[model samples]
Target: MGDDVDRIKSRLDVVDIVGDYVKLTRSGRNYKGLCPFHEEKTPSFYVSQERQSWHCFGCGKGGDIFSFVMEKEGLSFPEALSLLARRAGIEIESYRRSDGSGKKTLFDIMEEACSLFRTCMNGDQGSVPRGYLDRRMIPPQVRSSFELGWSPPSWSFMVQYIKKKGISLKDAERCGLVLRGNRGPYDRFRGRVIFPIRDITGRLVAFGGRIVDGDGAKYLNSPETEIYSKRRTLYLIDKAKGAIRNGGHSIIVEGYMDALRLHMEGYPQTVATLGTALTEDQATILKRLADEVFICYDADQAGQTAAIRGMYVLQQAGLSVKVVALPEGKDPDDLLRSDGGKARFNDCLKEALPLVEHHIKLLSPAIKDDRTRKSAIHDLLEGLSNIDVTDVSPYLPSLAALLGIRDFEVLDALERVRSKRRKTDRSFDTEEIPSSLPDEGQQSQEMPPLPEIALISLLWSECDLRRKCDTREVVELLSDPRLKLMASSIMMGESPSSLEKRWLEMGETFQLRVLARGGAYLDEFTQNSDWKWRHFCHLLYRQKGQMRYNELRVKMLKGEATTREIREMEDLRQKLVSQKGS
Candidate 1:
């Protein structure tokens, strides 16, 4: 496995892989581009052809070719490896082996089941579903492209088929195509029109079955399995990602048919949420692909509520969100099927309201009524709290006007609500500590500091620094788990290339963060190892001092500070102050 990884690495240049996603230009010995992972205007993302790695300083994400593909394409390590291996023209036999866990086998089973379903749809057994599709005006080419299929109405149809094919019933069940019941294994999607669900990489993972004439629910999706997660999967994402990236936005609908209709109607940048509330994982996926999202769900109360909830989720993920308010009593599928519907739908897209304004428009009725005004304001405040204040500030006057309240009053109430939310998050009754501690600023606790990243990079790259520096205190000062592990490895004399290989196995986000944070300092450390070492040591000591100061402050707040501990706290505070001054 390692040999295959090394071969892939040796064959593929990180610059070429990343260049496909980001526009790069020469900057010194490296290439620089705007980060695709975040909203950055300045080019803070850099690629090192010499090192065969890339990192985004703005978003603090960096990694080699494998991690780059994994992060950019939203793929797992195995999937990314397979993708890059194919590109490198190297066949990995071990990757194809089904090690009894059936991870790869599950994908094969889904493909086989999809073939069976398509065969059934094209055969005489599919007459009913075919007629239904014909009535819905879904063209043959569209149906063929989406691989629309039918499951036979008999209970044992797929079970018998799987047995005849000599595929394990357990593996088919794992693919969510069969279920074990009182009468052994049976088909899970009998009498339904099958919509094969593929991941972003176009590999079939699950199915969405819509019933034409059945006693069961109108639509049934395959249950969550080892290979499929609905929260992380978006219908038509595999097809729409390119358009979304090209257009710099995505259009989200609620159902599979809606996405298909929109795609058929010349809007190829549309995807569906599989008729569920939008999830953070889905939002994050969209964030990676586009900067804006337009939600056009069904024009019903439930759909409206879902759009509003999804609006906040997308907004919190730092994507601009808009709501496409469809006409009442019509969904995208129904509306697009009508005469001149496409033109009207285009107009709706043109006039889509920003999420905040759309949210206010939705609450207009309650805002007008005396009975529900206060409750409506409270709900609006809650929604607004989920977004950044700058994004919501422009709408405050409109909101205040609707409530017959002054703008400052509205802002004051919002602040109070935000404060309450912060208090709830803390969930403790201690008094606030003074803000005289080390200025960590707005950095998240999960993000490794630049000094820690630099120190680790130095230790990994400079053998003399690794041999001379006292790494125990630096390792103890490190907070990020991956950084601490790498630092420990370097202290024990791990080679730079060996560490880079090990680093590739870590999570994409951690790799990006560490690499982006520390990659810039490699030259500086290499040039003046003695000066850089001392600088990083001081930063580590200051970090340690801040951590200790915070711990003592917490103890003091709880009235449990001992005399020696209090003295130590005072000493650490002075030391941190002196260090900051210096």
Candidate 2:
């Protein structure tokens, strides 16, 4: 643990971390800006003097730099640790080695498994899966670049081979490769073509195996173990992140084939869940890459359900989710298979419907009735209300038109819903409201405001800052957790003695993804100057029941707490205490 902390500290910077998701401005000893983790109209996100920490006045999600990556990116603790550790050029080998000295963690074993899978795919025997790829119509360049492979059907292929290669059965099991039963360990992915799934950092954390028999489940995916979760991964993120970032958009399709084929066919920015419905977590990942997401699903019922789910999640994350409705129940793969497949796919993409239109189409006739219709339309409006309306800027006129009203009306309705929503975000405590406050529990459960999601969307772009300002003093004064975690990772990393050394360690590709995401955001921040500091203070004060203070006595005793300073210190201190309690 000490080693991990040391490594993360040396590597991760609060500036780069906070900057990756929040636009910041240097003010005195810290950097200040809108809280990226929560919505606000003023700059509250701050990066500290030491550049080792950050805090926000609005959202309370704070922690060390590693926690920032872990939460915002949906990565596990060890994964975050390894990522930042690598960035710092600190490679961790186990204290216990061959002589019971050099040890490896769960992440190490997973990496080894991924490599072994890759080796098999590159070998002479790999021709089978390679042939399979060809049969599937994927280009060879894409095939090799993706390292697509097949796991030999034999139960002992990976198990026996890996053990022979010096891995302990325990390590293999921990990596989710071979499962140990009463008799012995059996390979998890037997008789299947294997596709290694890597996180954005390019680490091999999971696998997606397709049945070679062309039977049963067609595709058998890796189950969520300690290391892998379907909700948190996109099939081709490692390759597609750059494409998505540059395009300011992404193509989310159904199945591994669609992602692979699309990338192979010039659309390198495409990605997909592993043959499953899109999840909120997945949408979060996509949104982190680009401001817009174009979804292409099979035009079937299941596809619609998946599309709707994607729309809600992507929208909630502040991405403009446009639905590309394929004709005749065809998926991207199906289109690529048909005559003039690529053209048809491109046409559909060009004709993609904004989420509002898609929602209308999905719930149209069903919502034709007056009463039930309101509920249905309202359901979609609520979803729309969750979107970062800032993302809707380009499409606002169209969106407003589609909302069947003007932009202000849509904005007004969204504000009303959001206003009522703030009272219930559970993100804030309202114990002080007393009995006088109506328990609008029924109406308050709504999501946060969407209109201001532009600020929210900035979190995903923090890594993209174009110009760096000295924000040392401002980051110091903030008290929000989300800000702190993000700040630590972004700011601290930048202040380290050897920034390039640390970055070089993470590999060029990774360095680019982190920078690309944050870089774009940083650019936007410098341009907006649309700070959100005071708004954040408002949220913080409100969270504490807009307290009637013993401010006079405390400030007198403390001898120097400005109202802002006193309130902030109290808020942060309470948070630290509560965290310890929890």
Candidate 3:
């Protein structure tokens, strides 16, 4: 580990940082959330509030806050550290050693370059870039908002401009805007409308330019420099972050206009990859806001292929990938210009198909030949099997019918292929059970889905259930151990707040033990208005008044009776009834 790493880790708490990114619900002593760096339906991301660290069981991403930022933001070690250090309010002493030697960070240089570029765009002394903006139909307000600028057309423009400002050509070249040429130096983004790319903190670190004439590339971006990686950025994530969080989804488009158009048209959460295929780095950044993402790329062949690759990439990251199948030959920008664009886009979202369905569609067309047709069917089934179909699984039979499979045997065959493919592809870890108790019951009966656990946990933890029942007396008459545990857990946790923390830290293993003792179901109890566990407990306390003695008195004379002990039987019934009353 670097000294900086140790320093930041010592000062910043990972739990606090990770919690800012993902909403963590307390599970025991730890908090659980959907991993922001991976695609997962249920949360496997665990953050230890006690230890101030996080570990994602799904993707195996684990670390302190600095590590999390570095990995997820695609920032360098120093960059991540600088961010954390600033967050922790760490102050630095001015370095003025006689032999003076401290290096300026990439961020520092990028800052200078951004200012220079902005100056050039905003009528830097003489020449103005406003003419360029006017020609493009981009409103001046839009240009200024996005920090549109220009680099002088002359080769010596940047070299001369920055040299006068104490920035060397060597440093400028490293920032990806200057290159060595026979006639001294040249501006990399000469004669173009510059679109400065910035981080979430508004640090201008790179630039993307559009050529004014038939010039070179349509879009020329800064090469990978110390501070900027083209593949690691999206065009306007900083602006879209709040929108993404509010919408609970992010729509990734293909170009700058697509993003701007969407945002300008009220879909503020839309974003675009910076002239490259979606990178895990970018996906990780988006993961901070939403678990579900819609890829609304262009509908060309290249776009379709890009969609497929992005789907797999994000799926591996644990995000649910939905492909917004746009109309043929249209991009988000193209469609947004249509008369009914918004409605069309929404219809697309409503019709958005899962990755597996898209995969099936891709394979369906090629299944013309008999042998290849069989292969295609198996392939489609394999893809289908990966889907957690409990939610959408019912569609399988309807889809089978659509496929014209009327016979049960043909349907069974497809299902079999699906099962086989699932077994082959999944290779995911089987959770290990250390004891016989959990294993025995699991072996005997199919274990309930963990999604149900998530649903129950949400309900049990947050909902005010008093509105559900009629009265305290009726609730007290309810019998079910699981329901009672739910009642107790909620009521007990409500008292101290520390009890909630203690409950959070308990491991899943212990939780499973509690669940196994019939505490998994919530059918055991009921409640009504003004109903609280304490209130119910008060009811139970008073109601247990009579039934305790009759059964015990009979049990005393019941002998150490055999399995057929009538007294013991009566006692058990009375005991159960007493438990119910409570």
Candidate 4:
């Protein structure tokens, strides 16, 4: 695999690969071009041909050819490797065989399942499902392009199919295609219209089955498995990502059908959540793909609530959010299907309200009703407090008008709401300590000091520091479990970019936060010798000791401290004091 990578790198020049995506001109030994990752007027993106690296000064993104492909294409490392290998005309069939994780096997199983479903959809068994699609106005090309399929109404059909294919029933079960019953393994998607679900990298991972005519749930999705996580997967993202990048925004809907309809109706940048609220993980995924998101959910109360919750989550992830107001009780599908619906939908997109304004619009009726006025005002203030102040500030006058309150009063109310929420979050019971030690959950909840984040970032950025630092010692000093895992991985020779990719795959955004917060201290840590790094480690140890000391002191105050705990508390206090003195 190493030799394969070297061969590919040796064949593909970074300048040539990047120039295909970015327009670059020779600037001395390097090429400069507008960054494809972020919006920049000047050409801050520089490609160094000599070093085979590229960096964007605007976004602080810098990496080699593989990293560039991964970022630009929103692909996983394996996908990027396959893409670049193919481009470089280097065969890596051996590399795929070397994967011991069984991911490749799972992927192959999913592909087989998809093929089986598609065959069933086109076969005689698919008559009812095909009729249902016709009624829904879905064209044959769209259905075929989306790989729509059908599962025959038979308990043993898929079981027999898998057996004949020589595929393990266990592998099928792992892919969420088969389930073990009291009798034997049965098909999970019997008598249903199947929607093949692919990951962002265009790999089939799971399926969503919609009952055409049956005594089962209206919709059923593949269960969480080794390769498929509903929160991390978006419907049609494989098809929509390119359009999302070109359009500079994304349109989010609530269901698979809605996404399909939007895509078929010339909205190629649309993706659907897996019939759930927009999770922070999903928001993080979008945050990487686009700067803004427009959510077009059903117009019912439940859908509006979902839209509001999703807007807050997306905003928290730093993406500008807008709510597409569909007509009452109409989803994107229904709205698009109505007379003159396409133009109306386009108008809705044009007139989508920003997050705060949309929240205000939702509360308008409640505020107008005298009986619900106070509650609506309170709700509005609480919701506003969750949003960034700058985002909410511009709408204060409008909100005040709706509430029939003074602008300053509205601002004061918002501040009070924010203060109350902060106090509630910080309110911890110190008197209820049973032991001097904090529980694992409590320890995990304790936010690590900013300096610790900076230290981890520095270690990740500088390979020499990773080699110098003891893995166990660094892991012990880290307070956050996530950081501990990251430190261990770094010490085990995982590259920072690889770790970042892993975190992104798992839908974790803490790495991004760590890098952003730790950027300020990177230069400081680099300029100072190893002493600064050692000092940060000492500070972490002292911070841990101080927390323990505080816990023990609380227990002592409550008269619950044992002799052992008392001795340990004293030792911690002394160590912390000595460290402080040093």
Candidate 5:
């Protein structure tokens, strides 16, 4: 496996691989491009040919080719390896166990099931599904491209077919293709038109089945399996990725057919959530592909409620979101099927409402009674407060008018909600603060001393200085636990670029910290002599020892320190005195 990975890496150049996703221009020794991982206008993302690595100074994301692909395509390490191996024309040795939990094998099973379903749809038994398609005016090309299929009504048919194909019954069950009964195994999907659910890389992972003739649920989807996670998977994302990127936006729909019809009707940048509500994971996937998202859900009350949840998810993911409310009693599929529906839908897209506005507009109908209206207005304002938008003040007048409330009342409500959130929301970044400091209500903790900050910043920016510095020692000198963990990772031989990427994954807070403060002291430390660096290190060690001594004294004063801790504090005090004398 290592040899295979090495072979794949040797065949695929980092610049070329990254260039496929981001346009790169030569900047001295490295290539530079706007980061695809974040919304940046300037080309702060650099590709270093010398190291075969890429890093974004603005967003702090940096990594080797595998990490890059994993972050860019949102795949696990194994998945990225498989994708790159396939791209480089290298085959990976099966990393699967004998019991068959390997994703690759599961993917193969799903693909085979899809093929069987398609064949069954095209066979003599496909008349009902084919007729339904025809009556819906679905073109042949759409059917072919989407690989739409049908499952026979008989439960034993798929079992026999799998047996004929020599597929494992256990594997079939793992893929949710069949269910084992007391008598025998039966097909999970029966008398239904099948739509295969694939990941963004076009790997078959699951299926969504719509009933053609049945008494059970009208639609059923494959249960969550090892290979398929509905929250992270969107229908047609594999086909819609390019169009989504090209259009700089994505159109989110409610149903598979709605997405398919929109794509056929000249809107290729559309996807569906497979009947699940929009999730943070799905929103994140879309945000990576596009900056804006327009939700075109059914215009009924249920759809409106769903649209609100979807909007909140997308907005919280930092993508600009809009809602396209279709005419009452219609969906994207219905609209596309009607005369001039395409033009009307296009107009609707143009007139899509900003998320907050749409939420208020949809909620206004519940204003029949004063108490109900006030409650709805309160919910609306609370939601608005949570949005990361900078200037909700501009929308307040409109919101006030919609709620039939005074402008001052709206402004006061916004202020109170925002203030409450600010007080209560302790973001992940807050965890990085020094443990010695009191929590939120106390005096603001000062930044770590300049010398300590300078030393860390220097280690991050200068390769030579970093190699000379004992990173484990540096980790001990830092007061912040997050910073200590970061330094310890470097000491463990992980590259600073890789750590930067990990910090980016931590969230926007760390990224901003790195951009604003982590690299700021680089010049000061880099230009200084080796002795000055050593002197700063001594100072850091002394300061940390004193801090430890003080903490132990506090514990002793509170009668919380053990006998061992008291002795350790005395030893630290002596060490600090000796160090001061030196």
Candidate 6:
């Protein structure tokens, strides 16, 4: 197992694995990017190529490639090991327990189902599916690339095929590929063209079947299984992620055909929500890839509603959202099939309205009466308040003018909404105790000076420089308990060569503070390591003097200070005073 891990690590680069998920830029000896684990305005995440590690100063989630993948993909260590090993082309030694194999069983079944669907689509029984595709104007190359498939109209056909392949009937049912009936098991998809849905890593996990010659519902999707989640999965993300990264934006469509049509028309940065409302999971995935999103749903009421909801979700996830308005009564598929379709589509995309503007237009028609206009304005204000916008100055004036209110009034309304949300959010807290409040013993004490924060960041980040300083005394002087704990661990020789590994072992509070304030001494340290070392020494001694003075003052208050203690305290206080004057 260790050998497989070593081989995988040797083949894979930390930058390569993380860069695929984030847009990292070179910074000094490391790489920096906006942290993917949380929403932040500035870049606080750093990746060190030399150490082969990554850390986020903002959220404080850092680790090796294995831990990073495990957190990002929500997999266990063993699962991440298997996944990364496969990606690195290192076959795993199968000495594991049966539970690990059980987890991959459903994924294997899903893959086999996709293979069967593809084989059946290319055979003689695929005539109907082929005719449907021909009518839809999908070329041979597009069909082959997407692996479009067909399922024949017959009960027990797929079940028998899986049984013949030595797959258990229970396992097939577990994957939602077949349903057990009174007589026997039957395929869930029949007489439909299959659109295989893969995860972001291109692993087949589910299917969306559109009926071609049936009297039932027009569309059907595989039931939620261990390997497939409708809310978390976005169709074609595996293929679209690269294009999205290159384009610096993502275009979300409504259906599978709409997404496929956009790709066919040279817009490969498009994905579909697979006929569901936009979900937080999907929005989060999009936000990690690009900062901007364009919603190109159909031009009907339902589509417009979905676009508005999606815009809200994306904006809440800190994405810059725009709404592309298609011609009346036309979807992306319909528009792409029309005359000069690609040109018209490009024009629409170029004219896509910002989400806020599009939302105003959407509500304009209902603002005829005073009551309706007031309600519309209220809704718009509520939406604006929910947005994770950095500079509301540019938006506030326009919003005030639109509502015929003063700018300050608009600000007040927004603050009111936000304040109420904060209160409500706090009310729903499930933690046994409030965390942000200081401890009872700390109520009378002030926090350590800000220079201590800078010193901590410096020692934690710079290795060679930290080796020159008195790390033990510095740890003892830290007032913040979390920082003290982290520094103490380092002082006790629990340091890992990889900074990311060290960060992962630190408490969450410590990690966040490091990311938020750790780089305070970066400029000074880089400009002159000697000056930084002297600066830390000066600050550490000053803190020590202040602590001693405080201790003497308390003893004096209790009338228990001896003459020698009083004289020493006075000397320490004078030294601090002279240093401050200098």
Among these predicted structures, which one has the highest lDDT? 1
Model 1 whole-model lDDT (C-alpha atoms): 0.80
Using all chains and alpha carbons, the TM-scores for the candidates as numbered come to 0.67, 0.57, 0.56, 0.63, 0.65, 0.69
| TM-score, cand. 5 vs. native | 0.65
* Per-candidate alpha-carbon RMSD to the true structure: 12.0, 15.8, 14.4, 15.0, 14.5, 12.5
Better of 2 and 6 by TM-score: 6
lDDT score, candidate 6, position 494: 51
Collision pairs in model 6: 57-515
lDDT against the true structure, per candidate, is 0.80, 0.64, 0.62, 0.79, 0.77, 0.77
Q: Which stretches of candidate 5 lie over 4 Å from their true place?
A: 1-101, 404-408, 411-582
* Per-residue lDDT of candidate 2, residues 171-217 (tens digit): 67766788888888888887677788876656667888887664567
Give the Å shift of residue 209 in candidate 6.
Answer: 1.0
For model 3, residues 315-411, the per-residue Cα lDDT tens digits are 6566778888889988887787788988998899899987766765666664655667766666555545434323233355555654557433343
Best by TM-score: 6
Candidate 6's TM-score: 0.69
Candidates 1 and 3: which is better by lDDT? 1
Question: Once superposed on the true structure, which residue ranges of model 3 sit more than 4 Å away at CA?
Answer: 1-104, 124-137, 181-184, 200-202, 338-340, 359-582
- Best-to-worst order by lDDT is 1, 4, 5, 6, 2, 3
lDDT of 4 by residue, 194-308 (tens): 9998876566788999998869999999999988999888899878876876677999998889999999899999999897778888887677666899988888865585457
Return whichever of 3 and 5 wins on TM-score: 5
Off by over 4 Å in 1: 1-95, 427-582
Write candidate 5's Cα lDDT for 466-565 as tens digits. Answer: 6777766677788766556556665676786777777678753543354345454343333464655677778887787778886886676557999999
| For model 3, the run of ten residues with the poorest summed lDDT | 516-525
What does the lDDT read for residue 414 in candidate 4? 73
Candidate 3, residue 256: Cα displacement in angstroms equals 1.2
